[model samples]
Each structure stands twice: as C-alpha cells, then as structure tokens.
Target: MTSPILRDPGNSGFVVELEKFSGPLDLLLHLIKEDEVDITDLPIAKIAVQFLSVINELGLNQAADYLEMAARLLRIKAQMLLPRRLGDDEWEDPRAELVRRLLEYQQIRELVEWLGHAADARAERFGRGYEAPPPDAPPAPLQIDLNDLLAAAERVIALMPDPNLHHRVVPRPLDVEGATARILALLAERETFGWRDAVGGGPQATLVDVLSTFIALLELAKRSVLTLSQPEPFGPMVITRGISREAA
Candidate 1:
C-alpha cells in the first residue's frame, strides 16, 4: 500500500511524496520548516500528528527513528494537555527536552555542512606537490578516524558528571572561541587534561558550555592539534596534543 505524507501544503490532507532522510531528526527539521513552526516553541500536538502521519510511508524497518521521535512528541503533547492545578508554578515545561534535542541536532548539521564545504575548497586549490623519499620503515597506520574522535567525544559527554544545573535562563550562549582557547591552554599547561577540566566550570558553565567545548575539541582534532584516547573500557578520555598536522 502507498502512503502520502501531509506536507501542510496549505491543507492538512494535501499529500506529498515522502522524501528520504538520513534519520528522523532530518525529517523533523523538514516538517518544522515546512510548517513555519518555531523550534524553540513547537506546536507539539499538531506536529506530533503530522510527524506520525508522514512516517507511515517508511514501513516499520525504516521507521524506527521516526517512531521514537513520534513517541516523544506524543508524550510531550499528552503532558501539555493534562490540566495543571491552579498555582502549580513549579512544573517544568515538557517541551524543553524536545527543543534542546532539536537545537543540538541543528548545531551538528551546521558543523557537518561547514566541514563539507572546507573539504570541497581544499580539493579545488592546487598544493605544492613534491616527491618524498621512500619511508625508512613501513608507514604507520592512522591512529584515529575523525568520526571515531567524535564518538569518543560522545562517550565522554555521556559519562560526564551532571552538575545538576539550577534552572535559570541563560543570558548568553557559550562562546566557542573562548572554550577552544581554554581547552588548548589547559593542554599546553599539562600533557593531558580531563574532559571536565577542559570544559571548565562556574556559574557560566551550562550544558551548552560542555557541548561547545566538545565541538571545539572536534574542530581541533580535525586540524590534528589535539587527540583523544581511552586507556581502558569506559575510562576517562584523555585529550592530548597531536604531533602530526594532518586530517583523519
């Protein structure tokens, strides 16, 4: 059976061909933009229905990611629909979690785009080509893959100690340049630095700080300025300076 995804094409019933995506988050970004909805302020119920409807074309095997996202949306919608008692000022907004995930995914998408563009630019320019002498011994195998570096970052972040941040509005977002410099500085002072130490802390060190610092480390690792290593399974990741100036 064929399925048609509602594109919100001026009518809820108007169907459009389902386009392929890398994952459910990619599809969610498309829907959010198509519906002219704000990421920070999602229309949870409406988007929830729309998302589920759109994924009907994907079949169960290909639809797991979308299904998971849809569940989150419905759960958020359900909590929002439940009547709040009068003077219930302490309840947290259920939408916050979804919004945070959306923002984080968007950031990763942008970073990947930039890396792609940089790759293309490097390909276009001519470089000084010279013949190198034969290696004295067999060449060394590549120590790390950039994707694995990112995974290492993921592991570190997943294992991070929750600062149990107090609820407050962030006045300004974390600075990437500042965070990058701090991490580099920490590495310079010592041969290696802990993930938490590289991330730093204070009233200003929000989760955003940790995320930004991670991305900064990713960029550094991309430039071969830093490396990440784990001595044992689930041990603390060590961030150290890389001797080689090469991209993996």
Candidate 2:
C-alpha cells in the first residue's frame, strides 16, 4: 500500500506513503517516525511546525482535516507550557486522544486493505456472477440469543466509569485570614492581577486555589483594599486598588 510520497522535495530520496494515511492522524505518525523522534518524549511544537509544510503539499482537499490535527498538536504544546501541575485524578495524558484516533484509523485501513485483496482474488475466479436462488427456499429469520445480547450489554457497561474503584479526596478549605495575607503579598509587586492570574489556574483550575483566591479577594473587598471589575460580560476579570493602595 506504500505510495512513495515525497517527505522532503527539497532533498532527494525523501519519501513516505500516501496509502499508509487515511488522513492527518496517520500522516502525523509517519511524520514523527520519519525524523526518528521519540514517541515517549514527543516534540509536539516541532512536529506541528513541520506538519504545516506536509499539509501544504497535500493541498486544499485535505486542508480542513490537517488543520484540525495541527490544532491538537499546538494545544498539547500549550497545555504543557502552562499549569505545571494538575490534580492527579483529573489530569489526563495529553497525547492519549490523538494516539487513540491514530490506532483506530490504522485498524480500519488494514481491514479495508484485506477486504480489497479478498475482492481481487474473487474477481479472478470463474462463475463469480450472481445466480438465481432455488425455488421454495426458506428464508432464515435473524434471531438474537438473550445470553449473547446480555454479554454484549456487559461489554458496553464495562466501558462506563466505575465509581467504586476510585478514591475522591476533597481539599480542605482555606482560612480567610491566610488567604488575605497571600493576596496582599501577591499585590506587593504588581498593582493588578489578570483574570487568569487571579484565578491561579486556567479554566480547569484546582478547587482549592479557586476557592482560596476567591475568599482572599472577598476579604480584600471588605477592607476596601482592592477592586474587581470586568469591562463587559465574558471579558477578563481585573483586580485593582479599591481606595488606598495599602498592603494591609
């Protein structure tokens, strides 16, 4: 199925295969392997950059498809840069989604290739044309066994999340007094904290950080130490001095 697609037209003897790829997911795997890059320690940013040139060669027909996968690579890179730590249970392997898609696509491609080979062999055999069915042939009605159906149901249910196996821990709440002190220290250097900065984490912020920072802001508000405002709805939340710029 290898088609010898040019990996690098700039250099001679640099090629891969079009038949090996159904879309960008398969192509991404080929790209990563072409450079002899480590899958364990993925060079996401570098791979994303190189993927753009490869997609360009593929042309507008697959423009939408390639762009989607490229976005995933960039997002994974961004996720790695920010938020040094995530909750142990909450954190998911960033590469898992892409890898899953690649595996599924590869399986489908292999199956299709096998089916095509079988069809070619059948075409070469004689008496391949369809013949009339025998008269009075009893059509067998498709019957489903209850046990077989139950087995399939169990298989599907197994995929569902099991709460019994998990251990969930609730983070202890922070003291308002302590939160206030931390906020004051954060304000010592800078006059304002950006929306994300004030929250301490991005959208999926830890419950502890969010609640503590919020209580801290409330304590500051009570003392007229700081102000919170947003230009419009859904805009960035800013924290500024309410009255006097006092640390206390």
Candidate 3:
C-alpha cells in the first residue's frame, strides 16, 4: 500500500520561512488553514479529499513530515466512516482527537505570537536612537540589601543537609525580570499567595522560573524597594513593596 503524503505545494501559504515543518501535525495545521477548514469541527471527508489531492500533485519525493500527518488523517477518516453497530458503547468520533490536537497547536501558536510581540517591543525600546542620559543625571541604580541576599542564600543552602553538599548545589543565575513582574502583579491583585502556589506545578523550566522569581523579590527587598515578612520566620513570606513602582 502507498504511504500517505501531502504533495501539492500550491498556495499552501505556510511557505513562510519557518526552520522546517516539524512533523505531520505541522503539515495538517498548514493544510487546514490553506483549505480554510474549521479546526473545531474538522470535515474529515473534505479534508481527506483535499489532502489526497495534494499528495497526488506532489507525486514521489514528498517530505516524510507531511506524509505522516496525511496517513493519520486518512486513518481518522476511515474510522469516522466505519458503520457503528447498535448499543455500541465504544463508538466515538475520530474527529475528536484531531480537534484536541488542533486546540493544543492553537495554544502554542498564540504563545509564539505573544513572544514575537514582546521581542518586537524590546527591539524598538533598545533601537539605534536610544541614548543614555548624562552620568551626572543618571537614574539611580536599584537598591540591593545585604540581609536579603543572606536570607535568599540561607533558603537555598537549607535545601542541602550536609555542608559538603553546598558544592553540589548549583548557584542559579539571578535574572528573572518577567517572573518577578508576574509575582508582583499577582501579589498586587491578591494580598497573599503561598510561595508554592505562585510557583505552580510543571516541568523543570517552570520550577526554575519560580525560584528565579523568589530570588528577584529578595533582590528588590535588599534595595529596600520591597519588603518581605514571615509571621513565622520559617513560614511563607508575605511580599509587599516599599517603592511605588507599578505592580509587576
């Protein structure tokens, strides 16, 4: 049996300079947009028709990435077309899986768009015409306190039991402007949130982001620009500001 592939390159407008089509799912998303099919209620029959038509146009030498999704789509279409027996509890629509996959892709796309906007804003802010003020009239550097560093260091050190374990503990780099802003924003809206609650649960990236946020807050407190209070010194700290900088 011939392997499925999306062959036609006609107006697949995903021709924009992406590094490469990552996989079949990537190709499916492109085809959906190219064919102007709704993501939620994907017309499997119509999509499958357009999909195979494109494959026929491409002939051989088609990229495996597009081929994979094409195969998956064909399978889904087959399953959807299969007649259901009476009183079958396992009868489920194949389009449901495709919709879920599309929803996830949409989420990633939205995040990518947001990041692009942020990058553009940063570029404009730091562009060629950006000149620093004279040294005498320079903006004051943010204040940093010694005690705050000690406290943060102490918290980190406590994670390790043996003094020898200190070397095993990597010193995390101190740069969390975004995370710091998020924490401050959350605190501003709601007076208190447990440190863990603010951090949330996820992969290592999220954990490290939260750790960086705590460090940022401590750094701010050292400058006397913010204050932290723990009703119980060992308990969760309640973060508040000394300076009137916009929350977050």
Strongest candidate by TM-score: 1
Candidate 1 residue lDDT tens string, 45-157? 77877777767645422345665777788789989998888888998899998889888988999999999999999889977975788779976665776777788799668
Once model 1 is optimally superposed onto the true structure by TM-score, how far is the C-alpha of residue 74 displaced, in angstroms? 1.3
lDDT of 3 at 23: 50
Q: Show where candidate 2 strays beyond 4 Å.
A: 1-21, 36-41, 86-89, 128-248
Clashing pairs counted in every model: 0, 0, 5
Ranking of models by TM-score = 1, 3, 2
lDDT by residue (tens digit), candidate 3, 129-235: 76777578667664547776678688667554566544443456544786677766776776556565455443233445667778877876787666777664445
TM-score, prediction 1: 0.43
Highest lDDT scorer: 1
Q: Encode model 2's per-residue lDDT on 28-85: one tens digit a residue.
A: 7788779988766677777877776666565522445666776778788788677646
lDDT of candidate 1? 0.76
CA error at residue 23 for candidate 2, angstroms:
1.8
Q: How far is candidate 1 from the true structure (C-alpha RMSD, Å)?
A: 29.3
| TM-score of each prediction | 0.43, 0.38, 0.39
